[model samples]
Target: MINYSCINQLKTLKDIIRYTTTIFNESDIFFGHGSDNAYDEAVYLILHALNLPDDNLDMFLDANITKNEIRKILYLINKRVTLRIPISYLTEESLLQGYKFYIDKNVIVPRSPISELIQNCLYPWVKNPESITSILDLCTGSGCLAILSALAFQESMLTATDISVEALKIAKKNINYYNLQNRITTINSNLFDDIPIHQYDIIICNPPYVNTQSLNKLPKEYLHEPMIALDGGNDGMDIIKKILKNVKNFLKKEGILVLEIGNEYNNFVKNFQNINPTWVTTINTEKSIMLLNQEQIP
Candidate 1:
């Protein structure tokens, strides 16, 4: 437990950040959502607590903080370290490709690398983003990617599906948040079961790809998220294989499928050797996402 008596000592933003970092280091905290370390996580929580912008952090480093604000900040910091909750869930908001959306335990945090492909308008993969008339966001947890896809492919109408009714409710809220109710529609489906027999120009998905072994050993932060959205069976390809087997049926002759498999690239390649996909790289690394044309599905 954090000593509330020390809250008065954190006068400046820097002081709070330093103190939070020390507390974070002393605790067993995991950092997978956006941040990667204690110092960065401390800064994130502090900035979020102060209701400040994340971009211009340096300007406010010396800003004086009131004791009341300090107490609030320290409480959250302790909650973070002790409870191992993700910062995004604590704030109930998350950013994907600069676009902010409402988030909670109902859906996984929006940190998919596919945001890069959406930002670039699917680029060399699609050649003409204007030609994409229909899109499907399978397993659309929070509708972050679905909304972003709608923004990028302006003319396309989207069908965002999720098996979880709770997740679909959150997705609907996000769609309405972006005022995209006219462009995006939500459906409760187990993959393509509830989807009508309509082929789409593009089918995008960020499904659960964590293998059983990894799921069992996941960090405490992940336990707070929905297990159904993170478990991918024995090899993390259970749902992926199902998609690979039926995606062709839902894609047009010239349509494309953008799928994110996370760290299961090797398993994906080894299993689907016949289907050659263009491994897309984000700003960080490659093999996280793959693009496949209808013809490539055999």
Candidate 2:
């Protein structure tokens, strides 16, 4: 429990940021979602708690906060420290490529670096970005990627699928929130089992690639997220294998598959030795995501 009386003494936004950063450092909470450091996380939490714009952080740095506001901030900060809850779930929102999406424990927080590629419209990878009429976002948790794709490829309609009904529900909420109902469709599918045999010009996924050993070692923050979203089997290639085997059936002759497999680079290379994927580079992590054309898959 947090002591409201003591927190009320912290008058300004700067004061709260410093205090929260200290508590986060002391708690040793994991931070794999977007912000990497304690100070950045503190700034994010404080800004959202105050309903202020992150870009205008400097404008609110020294702004005085009321006792009630301080109490609310402290409560959130304490929950993050003591409970190890992800800050995104605490706020029920997350940002990707400067776009906001609704998030909860029902689906993993939208943290894929693929958002960068979508924002750039997959340029250089796709020969005709404007002609991309159909897209598939497999394992589309909260439909963040699907929504982004809808915006990226204005001519495209998407089929976003996930095995979890709860995740699909959250994905629907996001699709509705973004007013992307016309361009995006959500499906409950185990890989491609429930999805119809439809071809796509592009297929994007940030699937579960965390191996069993890595899953066990994940921080308490991850435990709040669905295990189905993280566990990628013994060697972390179970879901990847299934996707590789069936993806060619749904992709057009020129279609490409973009997949994010975190920290499983070596395993990916070893498992699919015959098939070669053109690895996509992101600003934050190198070789974490890869691209494959329909012809590359056997």
Candidate 3:
């Protein structure tokens, strides 16, 4: 039997991993107490505790670890399981499109599937790829989308706009981290209030679309994140509607608008009649990202 009291006495990576495995086996609180894989979480917690990167653990998996390290890892695990704080929040890091980005309460954890679409340059509905000289990322928390845009389209100029200065600070760190200062510009704007009109070829947004009803129903782990980053108003489309109404003025002819509406697809579709027909809505297995051409705008 693993002694929970002794976990705080561990010192090395090996010892911490062993203790985590033992504790996980004895308790039902593995990986948010769901059927999800706990081993990955255990590994993440252990690596984070050691202040070691994931790659550093491959060589030491079978090696002996110390008591002090086990204790630290256990303490973090206890906080995660009991307090329900997201592991990403605890470690201040998240992986997106093969790169690790620093993250915290300043922004939502990077989990948008749009990264894959951008990398592949596969938004088929787009009319003119070459016309995509400038791209705008609205509601650009952490500026991941804008940073990735600059990296993917080296010739394209990018602008990242967010209402929160704290989120902008984090986004700027990512821009500097990727050495993309020359191609990407960070702006503090609620929406398009400060952006030049008819300038961008593509406008990407992952706005807060969680309606008040849904916001109240979010999991405890989600509650730990900034509410401003998640709450989308009463129907969750308040921000999106505002963007749609004003986006056309900012997009060049043939430009495209991509909006990520996670679970609010139904609400979006319900409001589709209110939206101009020129904008097309695409629904995938996981998300609904709407696309609209500038011509579609009234």
Candidate 4:
């Protein structure tokens, strides 16, 4: 409900950025989709709405904003605050490790710390990235990881699998956008159900590991993502457990499984006491993602 007066108050890009930040800070909005704070998110939204490059805000700060543009940006901000929609969903795009991909409500936003590990090509663990020939990205919503894997392991081929047909559509869209159709393929599968019994050199998954209790307490923004992409049953291990059970069948003898269970580390330890996994430490956390070798699964 932006009126003429409110619109009148914001005339320049800086004004909109300031006002948007103030309102965002004043409101109870969450900010995990991309930016971590109000000011950053505001600048990003303003730059994006203006069709300006997102990286440079100071360059366009004093530029005057027209009334029509102001209304458009204001409407975007209002929807973000009122509906709690993630900015990526609002903008129809997402970034993972600086690589951009088209995004929509059908898929969860790509925020996996695995992107960091991928950028490093699994490094010490995967001593020979060049030797890796096949990769599998499970629960690959929007196919961002599959695309990243293709870029990182240029010599390797990949298969991105998802249970939801709608989600697979987005994944394929991204895969095609990156012009990796020949290297990566999409499969409609309930985990391993429909996937061919081909083994992979690496299998990475940022599956739904939000426990029931945590899912119940998720911010409104998370509710906008598909429940199947977050709800991991009572212990946040429903999908994880299934993944572990069948992983051995799809992984090469020397291959590895990289799983992101997020805060479910404690639950994982409790449930899978027999299997030991190495936690991948991002600059952010030590417990977000875990790695396991083929022998570790059985």
Number of the top-ranking candidate, with TM-score as the measure: 4
Summarize candidate 1's per-residue lDDT along 172-276 as a digit string, tens digits.
998998899999989999998889989999999999999999899999999999999999998899999889888999999888899999888778878888878
Encode model 3's per-residue lDDT on 259-295: one tens digit a residue. 7887887787787665654333333335466567777
Best by lDDT: 4
lDDT of 2: 0.90
Runs of candidate 1 exceeding 4 Å displacement: 55-59
Better of 3 and 4 by lDDT: 4
What would the per-residue lDDT of candidate 2 be over residues 1-298, giving only the tens digit for each residue?
A: 5566676569898899888888788777999876899999999998889999888888888999988888889989889988989999999998898888988999998889999999999999876678999999999998999999999899999999999999999899989988988889888999999899998999999999999999999999999999999999998999999999899999999889999999999889889899788888888888899999977888
Q: Which regions of candidate 4 fall more than 4 Å away from where they truly are?
A: 1-4
Each prediction's Cα lDDT score?
0.90, 0.90, 0.75, 0.91
Which candidate would rank higher by lDDT, 2 or 3?
2
Q: What is the C-alpha RMSD of each candidate to the true structure, in Å?
A: 1.6, 1.4, 3.6, 1.1
Quote model 4's TM-score.
0.97
Candidate 2 scores a C-alpha RMSD against the true structure in Å of: 1.4
Ranking by TM-score: 4, 2, 1, 3
lDDT of 4: 0.91
Q: Give residue 273's lDDT in candidate 2 (0 to 100).
A: 90
Displacement of the residue 151 alpha carbon in candidate 2, Å:
0.7
By lDDT rank, best first, the candidates go 4, 2, 1, 3
